[model samples]
Target: MRADRLVSLVLLLRQRGRLSAATLARELEVSTRTVLRDIEALSAAGVPVYAERGRHGGFALLPGFQTELTGLNHDEALALLVAGSRRGAQVFGLGSALASAMLKVVDALPESYRNTAAGAAQRLLIDPETDLLARRSVAEEVPDTIVAEVRRAVFAGHKLRIRYAAADQAPKWRTVDPIGLVTARDQGYLLATRSGADRTYRLSRISAAQELAEPAQRPERVDLDRAWQERSARFRTGGDQVTVSVRVDPARRAHLVDTALTIGAEEPEVDGWLRLEAVFQDPRHAEWAVWQLATHAEVLAPQWLRASLRERATTLATRYDVPPGESRPSRASAAATSAATRTPDSTAPSK
Candidate 1:
């Protein structure tokens, strides 16, 4: 660990040019004293590390000093630097380690490629916290300690005990043989087996975790990617799914397709509108997807969904409708209208 820290210390100075002991301590998650010691160790090992004394001073490597670890060409190094900028490392509780490793990658690059690659990486952006629509992407929050415990068990091939909170149910403790951890779109899940049955638990829902000392009961080796794919296929197909036929405007077809799980039997109408049968998770899901497109899309079949949408549209129309040159009712007036609509028995105490 100290050797790794010592290498990280050198890489930090090499990448950032100059960094104060305090800054290094914070980055390394150690005390300033430890940073100072690491600096001494690096210098004693023939690294040309020097410190400046004034208030605006920090440790820096001599100019043109870099590690001889370069093998990647310019494009390969750029690809790595760009991938490193992504938020995947944070999903697995290795954000700081990723930073350190990225620093090493930069510091180890050939001087001819380093500056250009690093600058090019800065030009590209990946998965910003918010998108063009100004909608923020919310990542599931998993406690560091809990994730650490779960991660250890997965890698060490040990049974893991977790206080898991499944949807709409109280948290329950269960022991499972670990398979692997998978991250998709910033959400983390543990693929494991409980009592020889396949189980996948969201890392965020793990309120507590403990790695058992006993070895896991499972195959000696497995293909995690294939396993995850199989599980995903089952999940997508096994739900209470509903299929709906719909006609959508050409401009809004993509919008409709995005929310539906599958599309079948598509044909263009004479009026230039497109008709298609789409499958969604359920009726509610279908309603929501079609509703978002408003008049641009219309549900053709599933009479109940059409009625539900009609009722919702009617309610919205009633709420927004007003006579010409007349303003809509205020909150107080609306409240009075609601009160007036109630029968005497409506508010009467229950028997």
Candidate 2:
């Protein structure tokens, strides 16, 4: 670990030219004393590292000194820099390692490609946590310790025990043969097996985890993608799935399709709308998804869903309805009322 840190320290100096001990410590997540010690170690190893004096002083490497680690070309280096900017590392508790690796990648690039690649990567954004509608995407929070243990078990091919709280159920401890971890749409899942039966657990639902001493009872090699797909197929076909017929505005048809588990048949309506049969996880899921489209979507069949939506809409409308003389005040009227109610002292600036 110290060797990695020492190499990182040297790479930092090589990339950034001059950096104060405090800055190095902050970047490397260590003490200023550790940074100083690293500097001494680098100097003793015959690397031409020296310090500048005064308030604007720091450590720097000799001019023209570079490491022979340039194995990536221009596009390759840029791709890596951009990928390192993603949030997957944080999901797997590898954020620190990723940061260190990114530093090394940048430092290892040829001098001509380094700055441009880094700058270009900064210009691109990936998987932002919010959309243009200002709706924030909430990522499930998994405790770092829990994720670390789970990750260890998966990589080391050991059994894992977890106290998991499934939806609408009490937390229960279960032991599973760890298969692998997967992250999709900012959510983490552990694909494992219990009693030789495939099981998937959401990492956020895991309150606690322990890596067992026993090796996992699983195959030597696994195709995780195929496993997940098989499980998903079974889940979709086995659940209390509800099929609904709906007519959606042409513009919102894509939105409706995106939320459904599957679409059976789609045809254009006479009024330029689209009529389609969509399947959802359940009736409640069907109702909620159709409700999101507001007036742009209408439930055709599944009379119960239509009734439920009507009841909900009526309730909401009644809640916001006003009587004959109790209309909401306009903004201008409210502003005037506020001015009229204010006293001279209330409006005056404080001394």
Candidate 3:
């Protein structure tokens, strides 16, 4: 560990030119005392490291010094930076560790690759704030303490005693062997088991957690991707899922499947519009999804959903409809009407 730390210290100084002892301590995840000792060790080993004594002083490597670790090509450096920009590593409380590792990676890149790799990464965006419209990716906030505990239990092969709140149920304590942690839609889920029964607890719903000293009770090795898929399939099929028959415009058929819980079947119609049999969580959920493709999608079965959607459409239309004997107001006419309706004393500055 010390060897690696010293090597990192050398590489950091080589790339950064100079960094304070506290800064090095933070980057290395060690105390300032440890940093000083490592500095001494590097200097003793003829690493050409030195510290200036002034107020603006810190550790530095001699000019012209370069680490042998500069081996990553430009493409490799760019790839790593792009992956880092996704912020996936931050989900499990690895934000600092990822940052430290990325610093080392940048330092290890060849000089010719450094600026170009950084520039290329800057030009590329991963999960930008506003994407293809005003839609944004929202990062879920899980308590740092909870995330740290869950991460430790998962990676250390320890059982976790968790107080979890399942849907519509009171919070209860359970001991589960953590299989892995998963992140979706910026939220974290812990996939675990209790007495061979599959259980998943959202990180946001964990009120309390304890990492057990005893080892986990699950299998020796886990294929997390396979486990997640299996759990997802069970959850989807366990409930009273609704099925709907719908006619979708040929151009918008893909959108139907994309928004539904799952596509149960698909058949082409002679009129060119495709008829899709889809499963949704429930009638209400089906209504909500189908409403998005108004005019482009027609729900054929589940009369209750059709009625509900019809009621909503009727209500919306009535709200904006013009009264009898009144001409439809154009934009300019609406603005003039609004101004005329204002209070006579409203010449004061607008609120």
| Index of the highest-lDDT prediction | 2
Estimate candidate 1's RMSD in Å: 6.9
Q: Per-residue CA lDDT of candidate 3, range 1-351, in tens? A: 476567677877876778999999988889999999999988888888888888889989989986675444432343354354455555555555455456677776778998788789689877665778888777766767887888789878999999988878999999999998877666678998889888888888898899999999888888888988888888777677889999999888778778777887788999898998989876667888899999998999989888988989976775479777766666577679979997778567766
lDDT of 2 by residue, 93-154 (tens): 66566666678778767779999998898998878878999989777778889998998899
lDDT of each: 0.83, 0.84, 0.79
Against the correct fold, how does model 2 do in TM-score? Answer: 0.75
- Most accurate candidate by TM-score: 2
Q: Which stretches of candidate 2 lie over 4 Å from their true place?
A: 1-3, 20-26, 29-85, 119-124, 130-138, 267-270, 322-351
Better of 2 and 3 by lDDT: 2
User: Superposing every Cα of model 2 onto the true structure, what RMSD results?
Assistant: 11.4
TM-score of each: 0.74, 0.75, 0.67
lDDT over C-alpha atoms for residue 122 of model 2: 90
